[model samples]
Target: MFPRTLLCLAVFSASTPLLADTVWLKNGDKLSGTITVFDGGKLLIQTKYAGAVAIDWKEVKTLDSDQHLLVKQDAYAGEVSKSLTAADDGKVTLANGEAPKTVELASIQQILKPKPIVTDLVWKGNVDLALDYQRAEKDTDDYDVAFKTSARHGRWRHTGEGEYNREVQDAETTTNNWRAEYSLDRFLTDQWFWQGRINYKRDHIEELARQRVVGTGPGYQFWDDELGAFSLGSLLNRTDYEYRDGSKDNFYSVAMKWDYNRYLIGKKVEFFTNGEVGKPLSGVADYALDAELGLRYKVTDWASLNLKAERDIISGTNDADLNKTRYTAGFGVAW
Candidate 1:
């Protein structure tokens, strides 16, 4: 009986590497893990012994895996193989069919898992919330929640964001507002795309009670890789505003929008900023701006602490000019 048990244990131990993704280093080190992503010259692997590990792609001698992966080659438009097979140094065999192909390792640009329906889908997003209360003479309470998400499959991408804020002091509501926006992008080429977006804002206590905007324009993606992403857009918009005193204003505007984020310290810390600035063509308002900037420190794989500052401004409204700034710190979860 003891001899049979020993045989079973040996079989399991010998078969472990066959089921995992393996990376062979030039220095004769072998790593058994699941490949998470490879971008910005860093290949990330999730290992059981250690946490997620980032390895410089240049140092890898070769890699092998049985799972379907999407591998993009720099300046190459050919269809990628379904899986990878280890080859000689500085090369890998792409397992396509009866006819496998070999390619130089330096030509590989990105590596990621393929989705079931969409072979090339990259999705990422986050949600954050903050709350505050005071028991002093003035008794105050504040709540804020914001979220942004994006998904890209093939040539199409969808992005959306929303935020809500409220504050109360001595049983009186001082602020109540919420806003949402959505945009769609169809990639015309690798880095250029067209976008159409719609936005709505509502404030219960402010004189500028409601706002609506629809815009379309061109955008450029600077870089989107393992380290971070940045994009800038220019839009032409038609906007309408409603005031608490039953007044209304309409105008045409042109705006510039920016979205940017970066990972630091091996992706344990993140810095992100996004916002829009616009000038009204018809002078319904001279200029308007809405923006936020923040930093997040990851405490665990999915939990984080964040600090953020937000600014909103709308000058030259018919009934009132508005300017507001807010700061918050809180904990949240991220994927």
Candidate 2:
């Protein structure tokens, strides 16, 4: 009888999934799973029986976990890494080394898996391409390719973006231009940073054949999380322009730049916009704007369809005034 009991116990243990985390719901239901993340008022968990599920944060009554998690509390700027010990209803104890502290679960704003080390690198980026061709009244070919990437480690962040565009009509190149920009940022605080950037643009058909800019400024990071991020910067720039006729002009300018993106509908769709507007300090040009806005519908984890509109304007330049806008649609991969 003892041997039979041991065999039954072993079989039961083998059939049950091993879950290190558990949450007790307000309605008296309990669930065993691995916490994926808690963000935007939703707690996501992965369970063997039900796959991944999202529960309203308000529905969580108590929780315990053996994993190291980063818990951000309300009214607190920094994150805490500690074990979660179940306490009273709607509360948990943080095993904060020597002193264990209990806090209301409602006061927790965000929960995530803690990185192994502070200095570990985090990287994310995407590339997109659009192409068009026609064989009607006038043979035409168009191509647009753009890419943006960023990487961060410790207190430093690096960002870069570039685009190439070309169009041909009747076997003649009508539009050809390419631009690239790179920026480096050093964080002074969680939401504040200093940035230095350089940009270059070249056009094969336009009167303004070459453009170069260098800038330095301070930027504010509103927020960066699993869902989205936004940032704004003010820059003092020195811009140089060279025309197709070989005339060159340079001037200093002040500019405001913004980058924003948000994920919606369970992160299946994304809306983004980034742009810069500048006024020359010396009247080199009345104003200049370079901007793009886009929407991406994620088809899969790493694949998406994108539509974008871009605008470039240089009003009242000494040699030539410029205004151009373009629209594109394409499919791309992301990571």
Candidate 3:
């Protein structure tokens, strides 16, 4: 009877279900699995619905019962009101309310959504072509083309962009302008990054000949990983330009940019503003300043359109700085 009792006890212990604290080991490798049985240091792991795996006790170093659970959460929490009802003619009428608002669905050219999948490391390229017809104090018509590309790997990022412009007026000689810039950025942390850039510019005016400038700068980035991202940065740049008459001037400037994203015109819109203050190192230009504002809409996964306006508020040392404004509208594509 004593032998029988001992046998029964051993059998019961071997058949008992192991708790979450149990660990399994096999061939010097330790693993955590739902344990089904333990007998004299041998472990039986319940690997899903597929039978049990036997492991030796000597192979396990330790067992961890705690497991991490990852839960996905939505980021957008705001509610959109759909109080307007569409009519048969495609016009929308607002429901009776204290502040009634109505919109025309037919007038909506496109609908855009925020792209959460676009990150800093996606290989992409874009080109923009625009024709600007402007009648300033002086009549000016210009054609512009811009191209940009970006690539990233781990913590390093590279970007390059260039622009070409041609302007014609009835009285003034045709002017040709071109600018190119390249930049590299390195991420130091989730929120902090640093960048270095080089820029070159050339302007040609008939007999007045040509002018050229080159500049370089280093800047910092404050970034957030979320929709409607924002970044603020400042740059210190030095520019040297040569004129048609064999004259040259050197200038220094500090520039800052602010960027934001929002919903506009039934589409996602990106906006940015930039300002710069420049001082001359030599020549006739003592100080110069400029400001620019831009907006873009994503038309598709690989296409977008943008509009920009810029003002040159200051120009030279002797003459009062003349205000020059430029407007551009262009389309961009990415791959």
Candidate 4:
């Protein structure tokens, strides 16, 4: 019995260090676990006993955490302050407290902590898949899958996206398209940024087997709030296209890109559009454009329904197969 008791003591000591964070409420209540997000208006936390809980930030009297957090300090005299630090005994002191800036248990913008693999990279990602199937004398099967991810550290952010789509009728392949893009951005200020991008695409129907583009330029973020975000940018691109008929060509061009999104109903519904246009320095087809617009209705934590339309057009020349439009509706998920 004495040996068993000693074993239990050892086990408890080993488990103590991984215990959850703690929150003390104004109503004399305490919550245990990690805080997921603590904006000025609301706080979301995950706990072993309660899975996840949302608390009014005003009701939180104090917090005790070792998690690194990004806090948005209340502005004063037209000056705003921000920091990345850990909490200590319900308060955080920054820069000798000259301003004596005390954090109100609320108003934390984001939380990011370094871990073995994930947080070290500060990454977030989503994967979505859409499928359409029709059964009859002639069966149709079409699928679209996309993966998007982004990571940020300091003033730099990196984003990448990959997509694969295919369609078949009566077991005969009708469409096959794949694309990938990667971009890097450096924030010059709140409203301006510098960016560089690399793009690759392939299409079977258009007789284009491979296309690669590299561009670099500046961008603007006009609006980024609860409503959504709006951004526009332009770049000078070097493009190379390889056709299925063993034909290849390369050129230089100027490209413009715009992306926008809005939340329509609380956090459940969203509308988004992404588009780009490029004008070749010298070509019979002077310009090309690509655009995608979509609406998503979230159904569950990991699932959502979406409707989308996509268009691609080339102007000043007559290549019938080079321009196409498609509409799709299906489901998507994120992590």
Candidate 5:
């Protein structure tokens, strides 16, 4: 009888160690699985019954993780990183000590599980093309092309985007403007980051040959969730402008940028808006404004419908405008 009891104890301990994570929902549904991500807005899980499933993070009322997780904190929680195990009633338990501390779940911005080596970095983005032509009358032609991509690995992120627009009427060039920019962000905390950016632009109609801006500064993310996101930052940029008239100017400028995006239809439709104000410390072009407002609709897994209106303004420059606006609509392919 003693030998049989020892065998039963060994079997129970081995099986219990193999048990997966557990998530209890508000509606009394329980899921036994592994948690891939819990971003408060979205939750990803893997289970034997469903293979892989995603659920609204808000619907999860309680969760128990057997593995250690790196947790991001909100401002109210002192912005400290914590290792966590279980969450209950909007409170998460620390895993480090025998006497565990609890943190408010609302103050937890991100909960990261251990990732494998193959998934250390991830990338995604889109490319768009638009063309127009009218050959019968005065031989009118127009074309617009844009591409954007972003990558994330650990606490570092990178983004690159560029666009070109051109129009011709009666064989005369009326509009020619293009800009390319790249940015890098390093996370200092859950809500704050250090950022660096560089940009190059050219506008023929504005009688500008080329303009380049390079800068680095700190940035803050006010809010980021499934519904919407917003961020604002300021940078000191070294700018150089070359005009078609062979005049060249260079200066240091302070630039403020605000960007926001919102989802209207749960990954089907979304809105994006961004604006920038740049003031030169010493140059002919005193200040410049650049902004974009757009919407993107997911048509398929790899294709999306896009509509955008852009505005550019330059004050105290060679050729300034009260407001210059251009509208574009097209389909974009993404991967």
Candidate 6:
């Protein structure tokens, strides 16, 4: 009876220890505890002291001290060969035994699991709609409605907005404006990237004027993971403006803009400044300088509220001297 009891005790001890086993490899690396999940080229191991350690499956040498494990049993557990080669492009190539596979890194979706040391792709978009009204003591009553959409996929992004405004006072007038922009960002290093963008805008005011502008430029990006990013760029704009009373003007502009953004509470706050100098190409205009300052508060994932003030520092023609200050406040939505 005592021999049978000792046998049962030994069996329980071996099974229990295996359930909480720690794998010690020959390469001086130690992995404590049992592995719970293995997927997406990562091993989710739950340890006793270090909590969870997600080690790259490709970096692992052997498992359980079994030579048979070296055989390629599963797609995720294939044996890889390591090699070092010199390329003609002056770049050193370090090859692992695994065959070069075309990974859809851009389409990867990140999922959070039991253990949390993995990085995943982020893609999102939002849409918003807003209405605005303003009353100035001396000017006309201003009303506006806007729609906007913003989207990001991998390192590419796009934004579009359209707005309709009416001044319901002595000289009633309506205006419509639309803007669309697309940008591509390429990471040159961990903290820096190159950016390129194309933008277009059209504005029409009832019986007063119509204008169209198109621009494209390259820029630089400085990103702070927690504090957002700052960007500086120069754009070349070609504008065609026509007035209601049979007057026409054309101009070319070189503009510089700076953007700053930060997150506060659950909202993103952005500040922007734009300065442009325009040289007349035809008609009765000389040169013009314009400046704008604006602030935006993100209200939702797809909507924001903004306030802006603009001034024309130098007028191009005596007939259309825009030496007055203009203020605008509105809400915008994007999808």
After superposition, the stretches of candidate 5 with alpha carbons farther than 4 Å from their true spots are 1-24, 30-37, 44-58, 61-122, 318-323
lDDT of 5 by residue, 65-105 (tens): 76666565642222222344566676767666666777776
Regions more than 4 Å wrong, model 4: 2-34, 38-110, 117-121, 223-228, 317-321
User: Model 4 — TM-score against the truth?
Assistant: 0.73
Task: Give the 10-residue window scoring lowest on summed lDDT in candidate 1.
Answer: 74-83
Better candidate number, 5 or 6, judged by lDDT: 5
lDDT of 6 by residue, 87-176 (tens): 222122224446522222122112122212212222333333334444566345565554434443234445454444455554555445
lDDT against the true structure, per candidate, is 0.89, 0.88, 0.53, 0.72, 0.76, 0.48
For residue 106, give model 6's deviation from the true position in Å: 19
Estimate, for each residue in 233-330, the C-alpha lDDT of model 2 and write its tens digit.
99999999999999999999999999999989878899999999999999789999999999999998789999999999999999998899999999
Considering every candidate listed, which one attains the maximal TM-score?
Answer: 1
- Misplaced by over 4 Å in model 3 are 1-120, 132-141, 170-173, 206-218, 224-228, 251-267, 279-286, 317-323
- List, residue by residue over 208-311, the lDDT tens digit for candidate 4: 67789999999997865445578899999998878777777788899899988886765578898888999989773578898989998888756888898989
Q: Write the per-residue lDDT of candidate 3 for residues 1-335, one digit (tens) a residue.
A: 99999999999999997644334233444444554332223444656544455555445433433222111111212112223333433343444447534444333221112123422134556687888677888887878887767775446778787778788896565757677777777766544567677767665752223323334444444442212345554566666556666655556655554433433543356565544556655555656655667787878746888898867554663423345677889887645
Given candidate 4, what's the lDDT at residue 160?
96
TM-score of each: 0.90, 0.77, 0.51, 0.73, 0.71, 0.47
RMSD (Å) per prediction? 3.0, 4.9, 23.3, 6.1, 7.7, 13.0
Scored by lDDT, model 6 comes in at 0.48
In candidate 3, residue 80 scores what lDDT? 23
> Which ten residues in a row are the worst by lDDT in model 6?
64-73
Better of 4 and 5 by TM-score: 4
